[model samples]
Target: MSHSRFESIGAYLPSKRVTTEELVSQLQETPEFDLERITGVKERRFRDTTPENGEDSFALALKAVQDCLSRSQYAAEDLDVIISCSITRSKDRTKMYMEPSFAGAIARTLGAREDTISFDLSNACAGMMSGVYILDRMIRSGAVKRGIVVSGEAITPIAETAVNEISSKYDLQFASLTVGDSGAAVVLDESVDESDRIHYIELTTASEFSHLCLGMPSDKTAGVALYTDNRKMHNEARFLLWTDTQRNFMEEQGLTFKDEGFDYIIHHQFGAAAIPYMNAIAEREFGHPMPPDLNVIEKYGNTSSTSHFIVLHDQLSQQSIPTGSKVLMIPAASGVVGGFLSTTISSLKV
Candidate 1:
C-alpha cells in the first residue's frame, strides 16, 4: 500500500488590488459595521480583465498548473490525472463553460497524454481538498501514481453583484463581499517514507445546511451572485459539526487531538473573525490547545475553493511552515461540508 504526499505546490495571485474601502464605497447601502475590521480583508486581487489578454478561470488554472509543473519532478505528460475544481468556470472573459470539462481543457492545453484522467468536481469551497482526497485514495488503491488537484477561482463577480444589489447589512449577498480571485495547484505522488504522507483524509456533508449559501444568477440584476445567510452559516451549531466529527474520528482511531501533533491548522478562509472563534470552539471540544491558525484572508480574502492551497502556497513561499511539519486542514464548505485532512509534508514547495 502506498500513501500520497503533496509533491509540489504552485499558485498565481493577480497583481490587481481592490481595497475594502473601495469595494464598500460602491455599495448603495451604508454598512453599519466596519467591513475591513470585521472581515480582516483590507484588500484582495482581481484578475486581469483585458479582452485581448484576459486571465479567466481557465487561463488562471493553466498558469497555476504550469507553475506547479515547473517545480514538480513530473512534466505535463507524466501526470496520471488532472482535477480542476474551480467553483467558477469562466473561460472567454465572462462566458461560462459546461461542456469539455475544465480538467479536460487544462490537460489538453498542457499536452498531457490522451488517456490522462481529467474531470471536474464541485463541493463548494472544499473542491480542492475533495480532489486531494480522491487522488489520495486512488494512489493508495494502486489506481494511479501521480495527479494534480487544482482550482482557479475567478469568483469576484459575486462581489460585483453584492456591490450593486445589497440593500441592507443583513442582505443575502453580504458574504459575497469577502471573496477574491486566485489559482492554486498541488502535485501528489506516492510517499517514500512516513515523514511525507497523508495520515488520513475524510469528508462528510451536512445537507441540512446546504441552503445556507448558494451561488446563482442575480435575483435583481444581470450578473452572477452569491447568497449566504451569514448568521446561520457561522453559528455555533455549524462550528460544532467540525469539532464533533473530528473528535469522533480521533477517538475511533484510538488517538487524541494532541496525538496528531499538528504544527499548524488551516481552516477554510471564510472570515478572519470567525476563524478565531472556530478555533476556540475546537480547543474547548478537543480539550487541547489548537495549533497556530494559518490564514491569508487579510490580503487575499476568501478565494472559494482555492483558499486553502493559496494559503499553503503563500506560507511555504515565505518559509513560515517548515518542512516535515504535520498540518491539519479542515474544510467548511457550502454544502455544510465538514472534514479533516492530516498530513506530514516534507518535499512540498512553492
Candidate 2:
C-alpha cells in the first residue's frame, strides 16, 4: 500500500503582536507582578490587540486554512477530509460547546464538500501532529484521497488566567508572560509521489508525567488555570517533562544526537530557554553539537504541536532548506511526545 504524503504546508499568525518589553511595561504599571524577571518569554502573538474581545481560535483557523489553500493553489472542494485540532473552540453564552458542530462550521466556511470528512481533534498541544499521523494512516489505507490539518492556539485567555491566578495565589509577577499564541495548517494528498513522503513518524506517551504540565479552569466557564504537578509549579518540571520524552523518542528511533543525518530539527518551540536545553541534551546523547539549522525557537516561541510544521514552512520559504533535504520534526505535548522525520523532494521555489 502506498503511503499518503504532505504536498504543501502553510501558517498564519495574527497581525497584532506583543513584545516582552511591552508586556513588562504594562505589568509594571499594574503592580500585580514583575514580569521582567520571572518569565522566560521574550515575545508572543495574539489574535486581537484588545484582550477582551480579541480574535478567536476559530477565526485564526479559518485564516490559516485559507492561506494553505491559496498557497497550494488547491480549492476547498478538492479536500476529502478537514480536521481541526484545537484546544479552544466557540462557546455559548453558558460556555457550553456552542456549535457542538464547530467542525461543520469550519467546513462550510471553507466551502468544503458536503461529504467531506470533517471533525475536531483535541489532544492538548499534540493535536496537530496527532491529526497528521491519523490522516496519513487513513490515506495510506486508501480510506481518503486528500486532507487538510489545521491548528489554532489562542493561548492569550489561558495566559491571562494563569497570570491572574498566580498573582492572586502566590503573588508572583511574571507567570502569565510565558504563554504564546499561534496557528498553522498543512495539506496532505495521496496523489503525491512516495519520494516526497514522510520517512518516519513516531508518538509516545509517559502518563506518569501527565500531571507535570496541566491546565485546569478555576471555574468551569472561565479560561485555563495553568499549574504544575507534584504541588510544585516550577519551570524545572516542565523541562524534565519535555526532555525525558525527547530522549526516549530519539532512542526509539536509533538516532543519536551526534548524527548529522537531518538537515533541520524542528522541535516544539516552548521558549528560548527550552531550545538550548534540547540542544544540550542532544549533544550529550549524541556526543556532538546539533546542526545549525536545528533552531526555530528564537522567533516563533512555542507553538505547541504547530511548532514543528510552522518552522518547516518558514525554512522552506527562506531558501535555508534545499530540496531533497532530510528534516526531523520533534514535538512534545503535555502528555505525549511525537517525532516525525521527512524529506523535502519538491522544489519549494516558484
- Going through the candidates in the order shown, the clash numbers are 0, 3
Give the per-residue lDDT of model 1 (tens digit) for 65-163. Answer: 889999999999999999989899999887899888999999988999999999999888999999999999999999999999999999999998899
Q: Against the hidden true structure, what lDDT does model 2 obtain?
A: 0.65
Total clashes for model 2 = 3
TM-score of each: 0.98, 0.81
Off by over 4 Å in 2: 26-40, 49-54, 91-99, 168-176, 191-195, 219-223, 229-260, 287-289, 293-296, 345-350
Worst window of 10 by summed lDDT in candidate 2: 90-99
TM-score of 1: 0.98
Whole-model alpha-carbon lDDT for candidate 1: 0.91
Instruction: List model 2 lDDT by residue over 1-350, tens digit each.
Output: 75766777778776776766765554323444343333345666766745565566776677778778877756889888988887776432124253555567778987889999988888777788888888888787889888999987776666666444443334322334565666789888764654566755656675766766766665534666655442232344444554455566668877665552666676666555445665676566556666654545445455665777777777777877777776667666776444544554464331
Candidate 2 has which clashing residue pairs, if any?
Answer: 33-173, 258-286, 269-302
List the pairs of residues colliding in candidate 1. Answer: none
